[model samples]
Target: MAYPIIFLLFLSLPFSSAKLNLDYYKATCPDFENIVKENVFIKQTAVSATAPGLLRLFFNDCITDGCDASILIASSAYNRHPERDANPNLSLSGDAFDIISKIKNNLELVCPGVVSCSDIVAQATRDLVKMVGGPYYKVRLGRKDSKVSDAKRVDVNLPTTKMTMDQIIEKFTAKKFTIREMVALNGAHTIGFTHCKEFSDRIYPKVDVTMHPKLAAGLRRVCQNYTVDTSMVAFNDMSSPNTFDNAYYKNILKGLGLMTSDYLLSVDPRTRPIVEEYAKDQQAFFVDFAKAMEKVSVLGVKTGNKGEVRNRCDQFNNNIPE
Candidate 1:
């Protein structure tokens, strides 16, 4: 799992170099990233869940159809089944969507229709990660918002908490991610919260032996009435719920990871060593995470005639009401 960061950088160059670059918006928006940063600071500071929410939003957007912000699209009367309407994405943070809209409206005030919502999702997510104690990574711009946002395309693309280690491996492998990259990407769970329904299976019907008794018991309390209180949720990282760090791996080591998938990563020999390395070395986790984000960010990106810069993120350029 000790893949060289230098080699990863080389592998990433192809995706980032052709149509995307660090300065893709330098001439067009001039202050694109700065605007994204400003909006993230304002909106994220007001909501404790904003940082992790936006990060998860990025994951949802990218993992399905690259980083084209398709997940941000609202289901219209004619298109009443956009990606956000998917069951897996039904729990996506509204604050995260609000932050992107905030950035979009603010940018339009100065840059007009120059910036793409897809790029905003990527940049704002990177800024938010740094805001909550994660590594600062560069995101290349120039991605155009996708014209597609099918909910049907989403369900199979998403990784759920109930997936076993083998299932998780298959999912990531289908996306071109290596086992080490898969483990590194899972580290993003460090800051996010999961709804009780997502993991109740792990704690109910007898707590799994791999889970610590105390952790299982506590989860029972939080999720006991989750069926009635759909909003009930728990943080993924027990050690530092809000901080983005290796505490997730540490929590897994102590049998405190909140999901079946998370617990499996600690015990699966193929992934456990990578998890152990991340737990012992925070920098390693950050470096690989940033790279994984980069790879995911650029996956299946749309360009040129394939995409467009949407004036309103919730609807496509042509779908905007006249």
Candidate 2:
């Protein structure tokens, strides 16, 4: 069938060579990852939710012009708009930026000028995942901080909760991610929360048939007064709000997926099988997720002489040069 053909094509897609390697900082900064992990653990203790926030930050940064830390750039006096200013990125946690800044400061103390802000983000994402009981995967470093960031690009490239299966697939395919990879990456939803405004459509007008009736009722209760307070929130995976396990996929199987795209992974014929596989096998999900994360993290990356190591994670290197 079409599913098998698609799976074959996914297997056949050649991995892009981003020139990133595991040994990138071995000679220059052997303690790079340790510094990042230590800071992430310290921040995680104060805000238990920092893990998902950092994970989301990594995904946002990578999806837009690769994982060059472009998302970390703040709009300045010269340029009034940056990637984080975009509507799609408004939900991104400011804490993510703060945590990365903390890690960057500590790294500069030891490896002054050797580490890049982009690499800090990538490494911190891995450390955050491990801290939250997720699989520990090696991440290739050596990414440079991007100098350019545009708010417009985000609306064009980022996937939203309301996106249909086809739209989501097309977005991922543009980044060279396969359908299976897209599904696995969606599993990251296991640990995050969604704004009520983002999913109120499924609850109002009419209950989406895909959502479990009881789950839908609970959502309605949580969001009944959301209009008065747009900041109302709900966990993405009700089964396990903090764990990075296969519970997200299993929740979808039970019609408990919180987002429209989440529900579609099961209802759509092309993605359902992959979702079922992940629900049954957490290891399979983790393996595929790690591979996908590695691949996606390097999309459109700038290496060599392309970008610079930012002194401050929130500003361009040229804007605040050392």
Candidate 3:
């Protein structure tokens, strides 16, 4: 009896560890990643914002309840409020959700009920970064989609654009991200656009002295009557709005950062060094960003039998009672 119990424990060790790995789907779905990449390319070319949008989707998904695709869940009859309706997540591009759904549909055609939406979202994020000329890192798969999502949890876990560097650092650090990793992850801003309303406070009434005078003037022109036309937008990284590189950090160094949180990365004594380092070395930034992304992608991940692979990206498994 003792020997049998010890053998059972040994057999459970792999699942007990709960670590994700590159070959998670090797036996079950060999063509899984290629399919995700093809779908990403299709969505990305159709919409220029798709790349950054998907990347943002990955971050938001992970920060809340790990990268379990809870953010993709829509409100159902049982749960009237979902994470998607959260204030912080309100600005997420709808195209990202559509792209993930399309990819999940494609995967089901070939490997039905095998690839989880969580894994598909993770793979799409890596493909999107590579599509945008960023580092292509190996993603550990095997994440299961969450069956539950709450709006209140989103507000507690995510940092807003208006947060100070200390607040942002605290949030990321709580997730086991280092100060350096926090700074590197913020580099995702290199490729996205922000509405004028998100940053008008930095310029109106009194321009933030941290902003470069000329950059402030340019933003003022672009965001004229920002109070009335909140829809006006600007590139997060003015120099390389479409590229994923150290240009975002360079912008911060030059006082051209579009958000208060972004500008504070350079002004804060704790994060300034990492900002300056990444500003100077593109490769270094890429390496650290990839590591940080990989680490964050698996935070609080649910594996094994803890969650289920949803056939539809936007809804929970129908068989499971709400």
Candidate 4:
């Protein structure tokens, strides 16, 4: 299948949210939201990691190329490498991927090809947030899956734990996100775990001065041998790792943020106030996060013939006659 690389134009343009609708799948699949809700509940309850994994997967997909499901595409004979194979995306929660697959499979049984994987990502994300004690918001649907899924796209564009706060901000800004919005989106740290390797530098060789002594000592004890067992992990918010709330900002304010990108939210003057405000009020954080997630979900979105509704979330529908 012939494909075009996603252009820098996606970054350059102001995102248009006009095409998506709050009830996009209503007529086509009236049971859409319920389907996603059922699967997310089942997956999340059975696998404690499901909510965070799914949330991270949704974040990775949207940040890279709108909220299209290109991130879910597997490397195949037609395309030897896809976004999930990229180093930055390699840590995307398997439970997240599994839940999306579960939802897609269920949707097919009820509604056939009517629902797109991209929309599933958006809807599932919204449902999961509310399920995890975050504010609920309507996610506009009708986002079509992208035709392309190159590993190169993921390599060059995704944010990393190692990136400076300014660099991360630049990336989000290109997606039309304000610094306040970036801080709120990252409040997602309220639920997930990150591997020790992502923050080992702050604890090893020499302690990073920015970290609180207590936090540093704790991290060093847990991750001292991360080089040998790379699977060692730490929660982003030790206070309530399973809940989506303002505790992540509270942790950052106390110098307990798990990664450089996280720790700098309090140190960066432009973002500190937002972090402080959120830490003071969980409802405020929830409100801002809902708005931020809604905004980011539609950036550079593809609709109509710009993309297709894939039959399989894990591969393109190109082999079938278009």
Candidate 5:
């Protein structure tokens, strides 16, 4: 059950986007480096577990409204501004930054001021998924950096570390993703870690006790070894932890889910039947996942002269009159 919970939440609830030509990308884009900086910062923090979640956040934002750089900028300075605050949990992990640094170095040497960092952010996501073993759905590229970052929108759009199945459904459906797509997306969690602060509810208060009694005990056994505020609970679909695969559905059938969203798959009527079907066949999950990802990837790209291809992922309008 713990495994299944994680599977559902991870694969089913994580991310979403869409398509375009090269010319359309350049007109409405922002600097690619800044996006990398933000991605690096987010992946480094305790909220590092949120890398996948944040990926979805930006994707959704890009698709919903045009790839406005302001979408990622701060309107007002809060205690921890969106521009400055690394998610509390997975701060400064260096994993994402290391990758971004490599990409930036190569891009600096090769393309120089040609590629967009917004595209880099999108590419990093693709690279990470490939490294982890998921299908490499084509990223439409050419996303301009958004200057409008809204904290309230962050709360409204991003899935919490602790989210219910219903919450997940509502979020994905808004983007035109079907219930089956949500189930498959949960598979992404197969590779990441969950902090105790996020999943501790299962053990401390004893909500759904269907999990292995030893599971919680095992968690506590090494939980202290990790972050004082965290538990390095790995996702259950470990075989293809990084690879996007149907194994997550198979794991769900065996009751290997990790979180509330993961475990609820068997109970939720909308997703339950699909989980059952997917559990039996990996191909089905893969095919459906590709379709869903395709739907999400093409969200708000500037295909018809709406935006520009950002030379730098983080900066916008390098030649603007300042």
Candidate 6:
């Protein structure tokens, strides 16, 4: 009886010794939409009512270190944004800053010191999916930030709009993603818009009139006629531009993709089959997309007190004194 009692006590001790506290990720996500509704930036843009920029940052960081949450800061001011001399608003944007602030405030109100900024970014990313007419992604909490920030690192890690199939595969593969994962994740393009400066060369120097003629025409109209030369073009595959379904895959099938990286997914033998299947089934696209995104979010990440919870997502804890 003494032996049995001792064994039972040992088992109970482990459970009792463990600590469990809930935060925003552990609980249901707070009312993010209401928070967005309260944002001044979201109200300013004619089309910025949605906060996909946050989602973009989330995916961008998730590719490596399992969503380290460190992806939010400028690797170096050099790699930060405005990759070009011409585009001043390039690297960082007030829009993302505003959205991340709301996330921090809401989480603080509910969980106080418990929530991780990295986890908040991940959760905010998932929520942004629904905001822009896409599927919801499951977010794991407790990601930590890294003190290291290198512009060169980001330049190497991030995929450019100009990437070819091989280049994309190499980038994604480095991040533990497969060709199939690459195409599905690109479905995120379904709602976001890009500046003509990003893709004008694809249209002007070598126009593939055979494919996406109307889209090409639209691009030409804005890239050429508009003074901003920076006209907004719809992403996604084509048929269901706003919906986050498999229509992107179907667009590939019809040869109507907008970006080089996008078209390469279907044209490349390595990823073609997956694209075709997704084109056929929307449910399959959503399932695969969710899994791939989860894989992307957990790259080189730290969790739990490994770093400070940022008051602002754009920069690290200023109070900590760089």
**TM-scores, in order shown?**
0.93, 0.91, 0.91, 0.92, 0.69, 0.75
Please list the C-alpha lDDT of all candidates, in the order they appear: 0.87, 0.85, 0.85, 0.85, 0.53, 0.60
State the lDDT of candidate 3 residue by residue for 116-139, as single tens digits.
998888888888998888998878
Error of 4 at 271 (Å): 1.2
RMSD of 2: 5.2
Model 3 has an lDDT value of 0.85
Candidate 4: give the clashing pairs.
none
Question: What ranges in model 2 sit over 4 Å off?
Answer: 1-18, 320-322
Please give the distance, in angstroms, between residue 125's alpha carbon in candidate 1 and its true position after superposition: 0.3
**Superior candidate under lDDT, 3 versus 5:** 3
Q: Judging by lDDT against the true structure, name the best candidate.
A: 1
Where in model 1 is the C-alpha error above 4 Å? 1-17, 320-322
Query: Lowest-lDDT window of 10 residues in candidate 2?
Result: 9-18
The RMSD of every model to the true structure, in order and in angstroms, is 3.9, 5.2, 4.4, 6.2, 9.9, 7.0
Q: Which of the predicted structures, 2 or 3, would earn the higher lDDT when compared with the native? A: 2
Better of 2 and 5 by TM-score: 2
Residue-by-residue lDDT tens digits, candidate 2, 1-322: 3578867755653333346778888988888877887889889888877889989988988898778888988888855788889998888887898999898888888889989998888888988888887888878777788878888889788988888889999999998789999999998988978888898999997998888999899999999999999778899888688888999999988999888888889889999999999999999999999888877777777877778888888888677322
TM-score top scorer? 1
Question: What are the per-residue Cα lDDT tens digits for candidate 4 across 38-139?
Answer: 988888788877888888888888878777898998877787778889988888888888888899999999999999999998888888888888898878
Deviation (Å) of 98 in candidate 6: 1.9
Query: Between 4 and 5, whose TM-score is larger?
Result: 4
Residue 58, candidate 6: C-alpha displacement in angstroms? 1.1
Candidate 3 ranges beyond 4 A from true positions = 1-19, 225-230, 319-322
